[model samples]
Target chain A: MSYGPTPWVQRHWDLRAAANFAAGGAGSGLIVVAALSGARDAPAAVALLAGLALVAVGLFAVWLEIGRPLRALNVFFNPRTSWMSREAIAAVVLGVFVLRAAWLHATDSPGAVATGAAAALAALVFVGCQGMILRAAKGIPAWRSSATPWLIVATSLAEGAGLWWIAAAAHAQGTRTGLALFGALLCVRLFAWLAWRRSIARNARASAAMAPAGTALSVLGTALPLVLAGVAAISTSPAVVLGLAGTAGALAFGTGIAFKIALVVRGAFNQGFAIPHMPVRGKRA
Target chain B: MTRWAMVADLRRCVGCQTCTAACKHANATPPGVQWRRVLDIEIGNFPDVKRAFVPVGCQHCEDPPCMTVCPTKATKKRADGIVTIDYDLCIGCAYCAVACPYQARYKTERATFAYGKAAAHEAKRHDPDRLAVATKCTFCVDRIDAGLAAGQQPGVDPEATPACVNACIAQALTFGDLDDPSSNVSKLLEMNEHFRMHEELRTGPGFYYLWDRSEETGGVPALKRLVEEAMDLA
Candidate 1:
């Protein structure tokens, strides 16, 4: 709540803003994971729809937060200079491919794999756009760090992998490749988070506020998920493997959302004012 | 090549809050919304502390972050370096607010008066276009533009200058074309040791702070003076 010359957590964007990053990032990641994992049939269609649904939910939150919803279409006006505009464009690209792939997969048609691959690429581009949106906000030291984009992308990918594992398990399918990807992304996410945290270490208030979330992400989101996925990979029993994989997926996905929420809401502190030189009273020199 | 800029003489500012009042009065800003404000900063240990009042608002940067981050092209910098917002185009997402390093942008959704109810003057001056959109200090652009049409110099004419600059009792604030060598702001900058806040960010801020007048006294630069004394000892 501190204001004036001191750094303060921004109030303009609250929980709703966090929801955009969290849900959008994860949803885009899931689309990529589902496609890469070779999911087909109804499961592939369901995954496509599920991913799009999450993205839609995130967009809804953003629409609700805006002061003038009627003018929301104007967001596409500045693609040349604004990452937000690029994100909107990327969303359309993702939607087109996902819908095409979903239709092909649901009907067991040819070109399902190719369309899924195209959708995955679109999803990756969308997630990158989301990361750059936060990175372009130079006023927030935590978000403007060079490592921020990487952290955001890595966490979203991890979240996607986690969701893919659960979907695969629900369909009584194998979770080997998705589990491996999830574990690797968890490790990558941890590294990215550490780098991002280090970049903003000079901002004590923001670092302190985000410390708990960072710790939870490392332990629960990364370490615990890694352990569970490892156990699931080695287990011979189908039920046990499914249970472990699903639990790991839930933990990683849930922690990613919580971490993003903390980042957008709690860690987005404004760069406060500073007077480099002080003036002496009644003195010319 | 008119680049409007403001120079704040830190030594003369007395933290009177007069400029803030003038700005609010001129703009009819909602309660708790201040387009221009001064910060009272106390530096050093208690026994040797020194206090300074700093006037801060939008720097109206040459490369404004708010302008770059505005999704709808709502925030823009004019040819004269004045940053403005197109309220009709704004979606009120507040993305520009978070993008402004100076914390100068504000977004208000509803109209509220200073005393709970809108008075006659407040109601008369209230701007519906500003509600639910991003707004900031325009540096009194309307006055400057009007004054220009009237063939009056901005810094020299009270009617052409910003309300805050006109209301500064101590003459702490000066506004003029930075591109003009003989302008008030340009002369003040040349005669004083001035610094722009967060200059390292390379925003090329239009606002400058004059902290010392050593050059006016024909004294050696601080760096040169130190080098001379060291050479003398050697």
Candidate 2:
């Protein structure tokens, strides 16, 4: 009478999946922290350190899911043809830039422009790779569209801005950049909301399952932080009290991840052919 | 200045994954991860089935979103229009990961080391930082850099042909400078019915695919239908 496990869900949510969710959450948190702090001189440094640590952990989780880990390098040979290869190469380049920046900071050298540019490029490629990975999967209609990547990028930006505001309250010099980042986060959230609404409305099946949850997270989980950040920005409140904005921001981030994980798991399998039920007959024979 | 680009004659593509394999070998990437992926798409009902293989990678766009959102600025576009990433500088925020519409970037995980002891050793050795940042195609920047230094054309490295081009047994992948009118890629673009991925996004992708004249000829109709349906819903 009842169908078995749903194809949409992975067999057992393993370390890899957990790590992915955690990484996504942490990455978003760090970026938000950096944006809130406006530690321009050290924002990239902090972000790189946090980002890499999470990525390394996430990668390890992925290895746990697979049989062969060494063959991973084989993913990078096809920049001319493969998104996976390009992603590998980009990660290497981004790492180099991060190290260079760190070295410059340590040596008191003036390499911010070069390093910042490199990080920017790396960020774009990073998001692109995420979308490509989803697109590569033929079955997941939810992830195939261009909107997926854009949505990812928008969420990161929003989270980064939220984090920046929180950190800004801790430092005297970061107030301006923190507020600017808050504004940016608000804008990105708006864009992301629009994109999600559009996508959900467009796909009936996707809308039926994922859209309601996505809308809740985007509207409540994602929006609440920005609203708090905005309030903190405008109100002449004490820095200590305003710090609560960051806490709110972090909570919003968790909600965002919840929404993302739900969307991801729901769309894992293709809409397989509906099973036909057997007809019960008695007198016909 | 090396303005890197690629042109694919979709007409000639038979959906073979030579380019994928070539890329795998060239990059020495770990398993369960592909730098280059060939998408085999089928359209229409059983009686009127239509299949198309879409090979996609980093478009290396002129206004790359990844660059705009990077809190660390680890990725960059060169003066010659080739987008490159500085691996050492990347903190792996994956902010760039989300910014990109094409989904061209990836987060290299530590699990990559589990493929083999050798790969694990290599990961420990080469990427000691260990998944500390975002990554994607650099248009073979190392090869291009070396080629330029050697007074040869950029992206002309015999051993490093951007894995997909080399792996493409169908000989469907063509790499060259789009700026040069004489380049094979340029000529192919001019002669064939080519299209870039998500052309509407206006990312100005570095890669192009030539559609088969004899096939449905149009772009993936199913996608087109989806787009239309999305528009109506919106």
Candidate 3:
């Protein structure tokens, strides 16, 4: 019954692939959101290193998934057509920009903000490339929808905002802006997920599994964060506001990781064969 | 200028799976792997039902998504329209496997034999280079090339034709140059109504299925008219 007419879950990319997408997306989001919030000095350095480290872990996970570890360099061969190649190029660009921004922050220079801004642009490209990579997979109906890239970008941005809020709270910086950004992005992410779910045909088993899981994630990840952000916005006590924001941030970030894991592992199904017309038996020719 | 294509007559195929067995025997594919496959499809209610045996595999699409998504450029389409994979250059990332809508590509990480242990012949013929890499049906490219070098026509010569085509007991499968108007496949397509699987995807698959006789001219195919004319001339 292997690879029958019925759609089957793809086993080629497993938990390792899920890890790459989850961590890489969150890290890229963090870098962009941190830069946007005008984080500098000690906070900026932390975001730079943390984001790069997360991306490194993601890359390492994919390296482990590859069969030929030694020939990993060959992935750069086809940027003209392959989105994976473009993602690699974007990662390299982001790394270089982050390094430059980090150096500026270390020197107490005023231009670190500008450098961070440039790094943020590169980080956006890195995240966008990741979305495109998923969209490019024509075999998996769940990932092949045109709305997939938009959903991915929105979720990644929301994830980044969540991480940024947590970092701001940890550094004792004002987290009001981060909280507001996270709330706005959470709404956008929810809408994007809905749009994507509606657009794709839910014929495959993977699509069926993705629907309930995605809906639950939207409620838990988006609704909870929005509520926490709202309460924090109106709260008079500084400690209460910070506490709620931090908790909300943690929840949002954790949900993003879980959603990505579900997407890559639980929701990747191959399109099985289809016979459009059937031949009749004992028919007059 | 040559475009290799296959046309399977649905009415003629009996679902015997001889082509599938012949393909596995010719390619020495692993026990679980089938480069060529036959699907037994039954449709509709019991009183008004239909059954079909569909032979499916790599269509060698003109716009193959696998080739486009392969980051290492290991998957390539030859000039004669055969999609090939370079195992040495492949990084075994499985990107091509997911990108292939036909589900033709496969990646095996380790060596596996038909039995629990490798037979003497299996061990000798084991292809190490194919391990941990993307693999698919190549349309028997080696035989085609060898036959061409020996001045034999690919579709006309038994040695040049694909193993599946030669093994078809019902004469259901036809392989030939699509570009040549005189080719058997071209003539069959011209005579009978045919459809390609997933043609809406715009993959431009090289495989065709002659599902039913043309309704025009009282369901008498054009090829039969041509044959009748030839007989009268003789």
Candidate 4:
């Protein structure tokens, strides 16, 4: 039987999944940045823990999208040939490393480089897997295009850096690096935005496909944080005080979540049969 | 010990969704989740528009980022540069999904498994709870493993090429090991002005594209020159 047109409810679920994943991923990265940016104190720790909670929820949300949670192990049996398999393995490896780092921090471990390097590598791997996933898509000009993966990386770094800056007020070294990172993230964000705009103009359908989600994400997730970050940078009334900077940071973080969710939701609904798959005929009973 | 690669001749690609369809079938992927996809990119204005059918999949980079960010070590890169995922360990956090520069990873949701003919009738036969995890192209890992066990070359397959590679009526997709310099894929890369999806990132992606001369000769030549210059900086 030919599948009828996709229903709105199904489309809504698809979009929601996308949004949750995007937001969750972004949230996880932000938490890492927060830790790195000097959220070692109790308040910062609380915030980091909160972010982790979000990540945990997001992970479970993603699992709900799979076909056989029990057989998910099948993905790892052939790492020699499958990127999906490799991604799965990497996800586990990074998880252990990051959690260890968090634990080390909690237990007052002496190895800073070990923890830092592991977290950094995990961040990079996370970004790479995202890119691989996008690169693997066969069609959908918006997604299959090369810029998709790069954008994911840039956005993560940008968002991470932004979060780091917000969390930097709690630490000395984090303050310096956080400032530098903020500047760098701004530049990358600008470049990615420009590239996305250019690509969209060149390919209308591609642009349209991504625009709904992109606009929502940018407005709520990226722009809000950026505005807050800027305010925080300009204001001099004690960075952590209950004023503009603190408020902006909170808004940025919250918006980032909203933005991620919106993007995912849009992506889910936008994807349709640009090219139809061969309809599988029913098995002879 | 197992390096994987793919070569695509832009001239031969007809933009058919065969590879996409085949991939969905082989992987039994849910809707909105494709391990491999073909891109129909049209450049220039309507009158001067030139379209190219580029089949994209995981580059399985030498330096895979997915391996780093996985809080659970779900994704890993083999010694031979092939990137794989351990779904069992994946908490479905989708961190790799955002980190990937290619957007190659996908998160499965409830209605994803209900596609196609069999999926339509037997949709209820499948468990509903397994819809929450990340997924992407495996380069047909199961087939590749079986092939290697039987002493087959890295890219050659008797059962079926990758879903996308096998589905190509134009025979546009080529799969093999780039480590073997004598491999057809290597030869193709060596002879042609081939390009990976995003060469500037220095990820060392395994997938390569050979653009048609006609398309490349026009404004693409200028773009290529710019890309070369940018690569030098990168």
All candidates: CA RMSD (Å): 4.8, 15.7, 1.9, 13.2
Q: TM-score, B chain, candidate 4?
A: 0.82
User: Cα lDDT for residue B139, model 3?
Assistant: 92
Candidate 1, residues A135-204, lDDT tens digits: the string is 8897888888888889999999999888887876786776577778778888999999999989999989
DockQ of each: 0.66, 0.02, 0.71, 0.04
For model 3, how does the per-residue alpha-carbon lDDT over B10-41 read when each residue is reduced to its tens digit?
A: 88998899999999888888777788888887
Task: Identify the leading candidate in terms of lDDT.
Answer: 1
Q: Residue-wise lDDT of candidate 2 within A171-277, one digit each (tens)?
A: 43346455555556656755765776576565566666776666665666556666666676676766633575665556555555555666565533332211111
Runs with alpha carbons beyond 4 Å of true place in candidate 2: A1-200, A203-206, A214-285, B111-116, B119-126, B154-161, B213-234
Error of 4 at A61 (Å): 10
> What ranges in model 4 sit over 4 Å off?
A1-285, B111-130, B212-234
lDDT per residue (tens digit) for residues B1-234 in model 4: 447788888767887888888887777766666677777765559795656676766778776655554555668877766688776666565646644555577666555334345455446445443355566778887887777778776555646356677777988788887878888787666655567655555667778777633233324565687799899999
TM-score of 4: 0.50
TM-score quality measure for candidate 3: 0.96
Candidate 4 iRMSD, 1 decimal: 12.2
Scored by DockQ, the top model is 3
Interface RMSD of 1: 1.2
Give the lDDT of residue A274 in candidate 2.
Answer: 17
Q: How far off is residue A100 in model 3, in Å?
A: 1.6
| Steric clash pairs (candidate 3) | none
Two-chain complex of model 2, DockQ on C-alpha atoms against the true structure: 0.02
| Cα error, candidate 4, residue A202 (Å) | 15
Task: List, in the given order, the native-contact fraction of each candidate.
Answer: 0.83, 0.00, 0.72, 0.02
lDDT of 2 by residue, B99-201 (tens): 4555556666564544455554455445434353566766666766776777776434554346577667777788888888877777666654567765655
